[model samples]
Target: MPKIIYVDPDGTRHVVDAPDGTSLMQAAVANGVEGVLGECGGSAMCATCHVYVDPADGGRLPELGADEDEMLDSTASPRTTASRLSCQLTASEDLDGLVVRLPEEQI
Candidate 1:
């Protein structure tokens, strides 16, 4: 299992075990991490699972897809180059120890 670190807006950290092939949003929601709503149930339709990937680990993520790219524009927080829909990020060996910062608001 890969490990993901979710950092809340207040800087609190929640580390959770992410099974291979599971979306980051799923892992966060299953583990009760704050600040990640995952309201769309891992679908890219909702931006509620938005998170800012740690720049240091940015290279390990998959390229942004069209649907996710468009939805990011609708995030409650300002979008950054690091912004990504956690629903689109799957856990894998390459993503072990990945860290993402949750936005202040999801709605």
Candidate 2:
């Protein structure tokens, strides 16, 4: 299992063990973490699951796919270098302890 630390907009932290091979969004949704609507499930069509990855783990994640890259451009919040769609980030042993900061909004 991968340990994911989700930081909410209000600075609340929710730590949960995510099953390897599932997406970060799936783990968050399963845990009922607020702010991650994940309307498109694990697809890259929605920006509802956008999250800002901790800079420390930034290099460990895979680069965004073309579809996800385009969708992220339409996010309500400003996209940073570390911005990513949680649904696009599949959990793995290598992603253990991944920390993601939730955006101010998920629309």
Q: In candidate 2, list every pair of residues with a backbone clash.
A: none
CA lDDT scores, all candidates in order: 0.93, 0.90
Global CA lDDT of candidate 2, please?
0.90
Off by over 4 Å in 2: none
Alpha-carbon TM-score of each model against the true structure: 0.96, 0.95
Query: With candidate 1 superimposed using the best TM-score fit, by how many Å does residue 77's alpha carbon deviate from the native?
Result: 1.0
Q: Write the per-residue lDDT of candidate 1 for residues 1-107, one digit (tens) a residue.
A: 89999999888999999999999999999999968898889779889999999787888999999999999999999899999999999999899988899999999
Candidate 1, residue 10: lDDT: 87
Q: Ten residues in a row with the worst lDDT in model 1?
A: 34-43
* CA RMSD per model (angstroms): 0.8, 0.9
Lowest lDDT 10-mer window, candidate 2?
A: 55-64
Clash count list over all predictions = 0, 0
Report the C-alpha lDDT of model 2 over 2-51, residue by residue, as the tens digit.
89999998899999899988899999999999878899887788899999
